[model samples]
Target: MTQGHHLRGIMLASVACMLWGISGVAASSLFAMNPDVSPLWLTQVRMIIAGIILLIMAQGVGAQPLQLWQNKYTATRIVSYALLGMVPVQLCYFEAVKYGNAPVATIIQFLGPFIISLYYLVFKRTKPTRSEAIGMVVAFVGTLLIVTHGHLNSLAISPAVLIWGLLSAVGVATNTLIPRPLLTKFGSLSVTGWGLLVAGVCLNVVKPLWQVHLTLDWAQISMLGIIIIFGTVIPFQMFAHSLGYILPTEASLLDAFEPLAATVFSVLFLSVQLTGFDLFGGALIIFAVMILSLDAQTLAVLLHRRHSRNTD
Candidate 1:
């Protein structure tokens, strides 16, 4: 990629991360306005709005939507992707947020990359490097710190919420793994759009049109629009585009910024106070992601090659 493209990709990906990071705060705000609004209903509305907007954008750009049924294999994969990956990830995430605190839910969900690494080690027989191992350890320490509130003896976690949070991690891992082949064949935009549409349609079963309250003040409507556009549509597309210019590992590492951004937003907007323990835990998480971002072997090899060439 050209330098200009690389810079643009980085900017877009950063924007996506920023938008995604604030989603929890947005959801929290909406819920604060009316606690009566169920998570299910909110999710349904978000998905439908996001899906429609993406569809319109796709049509405007002349990108063809996936006609999965025309090919049996593609159709089956699309169905599986929607049912297992998209729907479960969203539902489990919302459920996790409902059952547990947002910080806990997000930290657990972020464990998806660790789980993916584990899967690669076990199934693909790819051994992790020292850096990766260190990253895992650091990430685990961060989780422990977060869960225990830095007090080892005061680790009082709700079993149901913990289970749901872990389930969300699994959903994320599954989604990341399953989409590779489909993405290679159908392109990320098409696959993502279809997945959103399918998941949105499924959600509508619980929230009929008449049941959805369309009337909203300007602030509420603006929040909804932001969630639909920046939170959902723009982020996914930018992420996909970034992959063209940056390595997957680099892109993944950039996403680690989401938690830090979320925490800052939570502190400023939600008045969520962070203790020393929280700071320590956040440091550990950042360290872990930084470790994972480095390719130790590649760097070592390149340095050695350079030295040899210089000597020669």
Candidate 2:
């Protein structure tokens, strides 16, 4: 890619991450306002709506959204991607936001790259270098500070929230790694549109949106609308498309921006009180991301394509 195009990709990914961070705060606020609303219900609603828009967008771009479904194997793969990837990613993150604050959830979700590294180490026999090892340790320590407040005996956040956030990180890893072929073949818009729509349909089978009646006022409706359109669809599209222009290493580094944006938004709008440890810990996590990004071994690992190196 040219310099200008590379910069555009970085900017797109950064803006997407920030929007996601702000969306985390919005989700936290929504859960607080509607105590009766389940995260599953919200996930279903957002995914379905966003999926429809994306499918329409895919068609608009002549990406052929429906082509994947015409073939049985591709259809099965997309469905698997939907259930295994998008569902956990969307539902777990929202559950984390619902149970804990946005800043904590977003920062905790940053553990995704470590999860990806471990996957390579265990399954693919890709041993991490010293820097990658150090980076993982740094990230773990930072997470410990935030969750435990530097006290081992007690957790600053609930165990349930922590579990959900960790699960979300796993979801992030799978979501990033599993859809590569789909992305290359059908394009990001098509793949995400189908994945999200299928996920929403399956979740709806479980939760059944019509079964739960929510009496949302205008403000709540507005926030929900913004979450569906700007947060869910737009950012997802931007980050996915940016992968075409820039290396995933640069994109992963920019992922740290999500937690920063979340922290700022939560403090300003949600009046979240962050301890000194929280700030220090969050910084450490971001630092680890940079370390992994800059480290040659880590960059080599990041550049390793899933099945075929030539595809990348």
**Winning candidate number (lDDT):** 2
**Residue pairs that clash (backbone atoms under 3 angstroms), model 1:** none
Query: TM-score of the candidate numbered 2?
Result: 0.93
TM-score of each: 0.84, 0.93
lDDT of 1 at 148: 81
Clashes of 1: 0
Local accuracy of candidate 2 as per-residue lDDT tens digits, 1-312: 699999899999999999999898888888888787779988999999999999999999999898999977778888888988898788999999988889988888888878878988898788887878999999999999998998999998899889999999898888877776677789988999989999999997786898988899888887898789878899998898788888877887888889999999999999999998889999998999778776744545454555365343
Each candidate: how many clashes? 0, 0
TM-score of 1: 0.84
Model 1 per-residue lDDT tens digits across residues 1-312: 699888887877777877777776666666666666566776777776777777667667766664545777677777677777877666677676665555556666777766767876787567777887999999899878876876788664566656776777777877776655567656776777777777777877767755776556777777667767777888989888887887666777788666666777777887766667667776787778668767534433433454455335
Q: After superposition, how far is residue 285 of candidate 1 from its true place, in Å?
A: 2.4
Model 1 lDDT at residue 202: 80
